[model samples]
Target: MNWIILIIAGLFETGFATCLGKAQETEGRESLYWWFGFGSCLFVSMFLMYKSISGENAIPIGTAYAVWTGIGAVGGVLAGIFIFSEPATFWRIFFVITLIASVVGLKAVSS
Candidate 1:
């Protein structure tokens, strides 16, 4: 259950980050919506992270956190390119793959 929460938190981390990018492009009334969405996701992610760490030891928690961060970062980059017209390059994909592999390795060793 805790692990599930942690995973959900990770997904929310991605959501908040993507919302932040979108919010940056807005100005008036619409900006408030994006800001509020980002804030809510951020708060939830942090709360879930706290719950997850409390339920697990530091090593596993930390491992899960690192993987979650990797997922968020990669997901953010992809979102930026697809949704915001940011550049998508082979190098970017390569780095994302590397990050994913690192996450997998971290999880394997920690488990």
Candidate 2:
């Protein structure tokens, strides 16, 4: 359950990152919506992550933080390509796969 919560929190990290990108692309008042979305995601993501790493079942901080950011980095890149039409070059895909492997490896070895 903690792991699941951690993963979900990581996904929300992706959400906030994408929202930031969206906000950057907007102009003036139009960016407010994206900003609001970013803030919402940020809060939820951080709260969930904090919960996952807190209390008795708390994950090791180093491992937890790495996995959280790894998910966010990979998810953000995928979102950039799929949602924002960013380039899907060979190197990008390769790195993404590598990141996924690393994250999964960390998860597998964690417990």
Off by over 4 Å in 2: none
Q: Which run of 10 residues does model 2 get worst, by summed lDDT?
A: 54-63
- What's the residue-level lDDT of 20 in candidate 2? 97
Q: Tens digits of per-residue lDDT for model 2 on 6-109? A: 99999999999999999999988879999999999999999999998998788888889999999999999999999899999999999999999999999899
Query: RMSD for each model, in Å, please?
Result: 1.8, 1.0
Q: Give the per-residue Cα lDDT of candidate 2 at 83.
A: 89
Model 2 RMSD vs true structure: 1.0
lDDT of 2 at 95: 91
Write the residue-wise lDDT of candidate 1 on 31-92 in tens digits: 89999999999999888877777744533666768877877887788888899998888999
Clashes (N, CA, C under 3 Å) per candidate: 0, 0
Model 1 scores what on Cα lDDT?
A: 0.82
Candidate 2, pairs of clashing residues: none
